[model samples]
Each structure stands twice: as structure tokens, then as C-alpha cells.
Target: MRLLLIGPPGAGKGTQAVRLATHLSIRHISTGDLFREEIARGTELGRNADRHIRAGLLVPDEVTVGVIRERLARPDTEPGFLLDGFPRNPAQAAELDGILARTGSGLDAVLHLEVPDAEVISRIAGRRLCREDPGHIFHVDHDPPEVAGTCAFCGGELYQRDDDREATVRRRLEVYRGETAPVLDHYRGQGLVTTVSALGQVQEVLDRALTAIGRAGSTPRTP
Candidate 1:
């Protein structure tokens, strides 16, 4: 499926994207992961994105769109892809439309994961990441490690990310409301938007997402 998954901080967009992509056999194309990969490689785009990311600001639309365009052009994405974290505002949404038009492709569904701001704050505040692998995530309340401040997967030190701090999470929510929320409206007008509660167990949420996508009338492509 060609999907765009939207959610505020702590809404588990990354986790859901990974799960959904695996189930549908589509590439999980996350802008956050793209930026991290670029930064880790020390590419020019990564250097530019790093500065904005460090300040808890959205990366510029041009740079973000450029990266996404390059990614979508790749052969692996021919099957389909689940997009996360790009098109943060109406302008970028329009840019995406234009990009897809040139390739005769467009989103099949846009899933908006809804979670209350208070819940988002609480979820993000307790979150921890492994120093060795950011993928090894834990929540102090919901998914704590066997030992305090340790990663269960890699035995790396686990610590809360700076962006996961309460204040930063609030800021991120503010940004989402002011910026990302409108992108939902942009797609809603196209009759391609689906709203799903992001609460409950991971598998439960994933099931809801799958059902929502199916109801939206886009069958997953056979792998």
C-alpha cells in the first residue's frame, strides 16, 4: 500500500510504520530515519538536517522533499511504501502531490493516529532508548527493562532522549497542531484520510490500522 502515517510525538508512528510495512510487504520510508542515516553518513543533506533536528525544529521543506523524492525514485519503492514524518504542513503536502503526479502515483490512504496530548506527554516522558541501538526502546511504565537504565536487547545504557523530555514533547505537540494537523485536512479533502485510535496494545493498534486501510478501499499489493 502507498500510505502516509501521521501522528504527534509519542504516538508510536515509527513502530507502527515498521509493523504495517512488514505486513503489507512495502518499504517503510521514515523521514526521521532518513535524516539519521544522512547524519550518520555525514552527507551534505545530513549536515543541514542535523542543525535543525538538534534545535527541535522541523527540517526545511525543500530538503525534506528532496530526500523523499530521491527515496521514492528508488527501485525498491516500486512495490509501495509507507511514509512517516515528511510533509509536515500544507505546503509540503502540495509538494508531495506534485511529486507523485510526475510519477503517476499518489497515496492510497493517509492514516492519522489519534492520541490525547496528555497521554502523549506521559508516554514520551517515560520513554528510554539504548545507547547502542536507538531501535531498542523502553518505557519506564509500560515496557521497562529488567534492570533500571539498561537495554534489554543489547545491554547498552538506556536513557531518555533529550527530545523526549516533557518540555520538548510539549513543544513538539504544539508544532504538530500548528503544522502537521493541517496536512490531515489536505488529504481529507481527497477522501483518502483515515483516523484511528492509537491507544491499546501494539498489536491491537496495528489491527485497527490494517482494518482502516482496508476499509479505505486500497487492497495491499501481493508480495
Candidate 2:
């Protein structure tokens, strides 16, 4: 399935993207990976993007769109692709429409993982990452480690990530809503949106997403 996955911060969108791409036998194309690939190759677009990113500013749409355009041209994308993290706003969404239209293809579904903003804040703010392995995570309430300030797996310091601070998370959520709402609206107009609750276990959420996608597929698209 050719799909666009949208979710706010702490919505578990990353995890679901991996699973959906695998299950559907499609290439998972994440914008972060696209940026890394460009930067690793020392492309001009990457250099520009690096400069802006280092300044804690959003990368210009031209550079990001250029990176995504190249990624979409790869051979693996011929089968299908699941796009994550691209098209953060309506303008990028329009750019994506143009890109795919040039190839005479369009997204079959736009999977929107829905979760309350308050819960999103709680989910992120409660997270603690291991000093040794940042991937080792524990939630203060849901999955706290044996010791309060230590990583159970690595016996390392467990500290809340700066981005996971409540204030930071709230700001991120605010930005997400402001940027992402219109993108959702754009797809909704095309009748491609498949909304699914992101609450509950991963498997349950995945099942809901699949069901939602299936239902969207059965509906006729607008011209």
C-alpha cells in the first residue's frame, strides 16, 4: 500500500510505521533517514539542511522536498512506500501531491494515528532514557525501572530527556497541531484519510489501523 502516516509527537507513529511497512511489504521511507542519507553523502541540500538544523530551525521546504524526491525515485519505492515524517504541513503535502502526480501515482491511504494532546504530553513527559543506551526507556508511571534513577537493563543513569520535559512536550504538541491539522484536512478532502485511535497496546492499535485502511480502500476516491 502507498501510504502517508501522520501522528503528533509521542503518538507511537514511528513504531507503527515500521510495523505497517513490514506487514504490507512496502519500503518504509522516513524523512529523518532521507535527511541522514543526504547529509552523509555531503549533498548541497544536506549542507543547507545541516546549517538550519544546527541553528535549531526548521529546514527549508526546498531542501527537505529535494531529499524526499530523491528517496521516492529509488528502485525499492517501485513496489510501494510508506511515508513517515514528510509533509509536515499543507505546503509539503501539496509538494508531495505534485511529486507523485508526476509519476501518475498517489497515496492509497493516509493513516492518522489519533491520541489526546494531554495523553501525548503525559506519555512523553514520563519517559526516562538510559545514559548508556538512549534506546533503553522507562516510563515513570507505566513502566518504571526497579530503581527510581537507574536503568534496570544497563545499570546506568536514567534521566528524563530534555525534549521529554513537560514544557517542551507541550510546545511540541502545540506546533504539531498547528502544522498537522491542515495536512490532515488536505487528505480528508481527497477521501484518503484513515483515522485510528493510538491508545491501547501496539498490536491493538495496529489492528485498528489496518481495519481503518481496509475501510478507506473500499471507499471511492474523489477525482
Candidate 3:
């Protein structure tokens, strides 16, 4: 199924995207990963994005669109792909629409994982990471590693991200409310949005998401 997964930070969109992509046998295309790949390869688009990123400015929409276009053009995407972390605003959404139109394909569904702001704040604030691999996640209260200040896998130091600090979490939440929330309405109007509560165990939430999409009755199942 061609899908778009949207949610606030810490909402487990990344986790679900990985699982759903595997389940449905489709490529998982995350904008963040795309940018990282491009930058690592030092492509022209990557260089432009790096310039804006280093300046602490948002990468221009067209640059992002270019990366996405190239990704979607890949032959492996012919079956379908799951999109995460792109189309962050209405303009990007419109650009996506145009791109899909030109390619004669369109999204089948947009899954909006809804979680309360208070819960999101608490979850993010309690988050910790392994120093050796910052992406190795844990939660101080919810799911702490076996040893305090150390990674369970590699015994690396555990540290909290500055962005996961309470003060930074609030700012990120505010930005999501101001900028990302409106995209929900945009998809809603198109009758393509499936809202699923995202406040439960990760597997439970994924089940809920699958149920919601199944009920939508528009998504194709893998044969």
C-alpha cells in the first residue's frame, strides 16, 4: 500500500513505518534518511541542503521536492512506498500532489497518529540515548536500560539529547502545533486521512493503525 504516516515527534511513526513497510513489502522512504544519504554522497542537492542546515535554516521546499522526486522514480518504488517526514506543510503537500500527478500515481492513505500533548511531552522528556549510537533509545521512566547511564547492548554511555530536554520539547511541540497540525486538515478534506489513537504499547498502536486503515477500505493488501 502507498501510505503517508504523520505524527508529532516521539509518536513512534518511525517504528511503525519500518514495520508496516516490511509487512506490506514496500520501500520505506523517510525524508530524513534521504537527506542523510544525499549529504553522505555529497550530491548537489545534498550540498544545497547542507548549506541551509548548517545555517540553521529550513531547507528550501524545492530542494526537498527534488530529493523526493528522485526517490520515487526508483524502480523498486513501483510496488509502492511508505512516506515519512516529508510534506510537512501544505505547500509541500501540494508539491507532492503535483509530483504524483506527473508520475500518474497517488497516495492511498494518510495515517495520522494522534497523541495528547501532555503525554508527548512526558514521553520525550523522559527519553535517553546510548552515547555510542545516539539512535539507541530508552526511556527513563517507561523503558530505561538495564544500567543507568549505560547502553544495554554495547555498554555505551547513556545521555539525554538537548532537544529532548523539557524546554526544547516544549518548543518543538509549539512548532508542530503551529506548522504540522494544519496538514491534518488538508488531508482530512481530501478524505484520505485515517486518525488512530497513539497512546499505548507500540504493538498495540500498530494494531490500531492497521485496523484503522483496513476500515478505511481503500488501501490495497499485499498478495
Highest-scoring model, lDDT: 2
The lDDT ranking, best first, is 2, 1, 3
For each candidate, what is the lDDT? 0.90, 0.91, 0.88
Q: Residue 30 of candidate 2: its Cα lDDT?
A: 92
Model 1, 119-204: lDDT tens digits are 99999999999999999999999899999999998899999989899999999899899989999999998888899999999999
Write down the RMSD of candidate 3 (Cα, Å).
Answer: 3.1
* RMSD for each of the candidates: 4.1, 1.4, 3.1
lDDT of 3 by residue, 1-223 (tens): 6789999987988999998888889999999899989999999999999999899999999999999999999999999899999889988998888888887777888999988888988998998888888889889988888888888989999888898898898899889888888888887877789889989898899899888778765545221
Best model number under TM-score: 2
Number of clashing residue pairs in every model? 0, 0, 0
Q: Give candidate 3's error at residue 40 in angstroms.
A: 2.4
For model 3, state the Cα shift of residue 210 in Å: 1.3
TM-score per candidate, chains pooled: 0.82, 0.95, 0.89
